[model samples]
Target: MAVTASGVFRRTAIERADQRVSWERTDQAFFSSGACHVLAWTCRDFYPDQGIALAALYLGDFEHPLHVYARWGRWVFDASGWNLESELLQANSDFEGLPVREVETIRTDLREFCEKHVHRQPHQYWADPTERARAYVARYNPPWL
Candidate 1:
């Protein structure tokens, strides 16, 4: 048996947060604000057959994406966890009544996505994603492991 997409999301989120990669500037849990797109793409890639796609939670304007997460049907997966689309909105007060756009065109390259969308000092996180992931899992020792 293999890990589910939600499992991958949870593990990836926690590990990435723990890694505290250079691009991230947050002391909060979950992924950094600017790393959402990369994290969402990672979750989608981990379960390609699951039809997981990326979606952007925008503020009042569609011109910018305030947050990004993976979506499979009506369910959304983020660093926080798996949640219903409505629940995700309600959980984040800023996005409670905002618009969410399903990203139709996903860039195949992480670097490209960062260059185009990430507002901060965007990083590709491609130096050794698997190795970096392992570093976190080793330190945290999640019970499910």
Candidate 2:
């Protein structure tokens, strides 16, 4: 997996595929994980080098938006030319004003980081993003997610 000049995700599977295959692969992942898992995975994949901000984001509850966002902006700063401001920017997207693309990107990067550094083929899609997120909180949080 590699990041493009525009800081866009260039996955190994994505880069090798022809247009149709690429679309199919991405679309498949999207449906299986929902759009949010993509973002969570991004954070999980990238930033494995370790940082408090991202850790908090991964462990932090959804009620607090800043934890995930601060790390995203930090990655944007580290990577350069990233529009980190979009961390929470909501646009009129498919899910009725869903602005999750940026977070998805972050999750993707984080996942890549984990794979490259830790060599863990961690699965992001655990049936549901919300359930998975709750599980994450459960495991990482003090008592329950």
Candidate 3:
């Protein structure tokens, strides 16, 4: 699904100092990549009260290290410490109402696509450290920040 600029989704506020430090560390890792290929999709939640799920994959360094992030309702789940495949399947099933088999298929397709198409360096804006920082700030700066 296309990401909208409607301002409906806002970054969750960091209430504790530890959370702030952790977020900064994660953000640093995310932006440290010389290049990254991103794949994102939005799916309807099976539980209507939970709203929608926004899922994204960040591929870098030929997939030696990949990252997955999914937002369901107000919670953001990461594949940092959990089992990646199981986490992905669970998220897809819980948020998208997709069957296990279909989620597997989607995962395979995404992997193939990344393997085939993400060989080159990222755009200049992403490649340049200064530009990347500017872009990040522009994209994520909210009133609360």
Candidate 4:
């Protein structure tokens, strides 16, 4: 199948996440393994006026969210573009038998969230996530988008 723009974004985001994790001397795929919040924040920042909210896909235990993505209405956006929520959920077998919860707001403090979940401290480069996200979106944005 032809690669979609969403696919490109997803791959590039994962590559970026991998590079971020590599700084800690590991070779794991952080984006797929645990760092989805980065993409969720990127999506939210890029579409600030779209009423986009965050959602979590629970892991084996319903209490722990294993994945986070952005949702606007019935559409979901992560590293990928806007996709139907049900379809997106169905595409990931990891979510097949799990519960999902829509987060009304990010409860944790931003820096704390990054330190705890993202495993990255605030740096001069990415201290302001909104700026970083905006730059990334602008880099990949097409006129048609």
TM-score of model number 4: 0.54
Residue-level lDDT tens digits of model 2 in 1-145: 1112211323345434333343344432331222333334443344455442332222123332222222443343112113343332321122232333323233335456445334223343323243333333223221111
Question: Candidate 2 — which residues are off by over 4 angstroms?
Answer: 1-35, 50-70, 74-82, 86-88, 92-145
Residue 14 of model 2 has an lDDT of: 45
lDDT score at residue 135, model 4, on the 0-100 scale: 51
Residue 130 in candidate 1, Cα distance off native in Å? 5.9
TM-score for candidate 1, residues paired by index: 0.56
Candidate 1: Cα lDDT at 7: 19
Name model 3 segments beyond 4 Å from true.
1-78, 102-112, 115-125, 128-145
**Once superposed on the true structure, which residue ranges of model 4 sit more than 4 Å away at CA?**
1-30, 94-109, 112-145
Clash count for each candidate, listed in order shown = 0, 20, 0, 0
Q: Deviation in angstroms for 126 in model 3?
A: 1.6
Candidate 1 overall Cα lDDT vs. reference?
A: 0.49
lDDT, residue 110, model 2? 48
Q: Give all candidates' CA lDDT scores.
A: 0.49, 0.31, 0.32, 0.49
Model 2 root-mean-square deviation: 14.0
Question: Judged by lDDT relative to the true structure, which candidate is superior, 2 or 4?
Answer: 4
Q: What lDDT does model 3 reach?
A: 0.32
Q: What's the best-to-worst order under TM-score? A: 1, 4, 2, 3
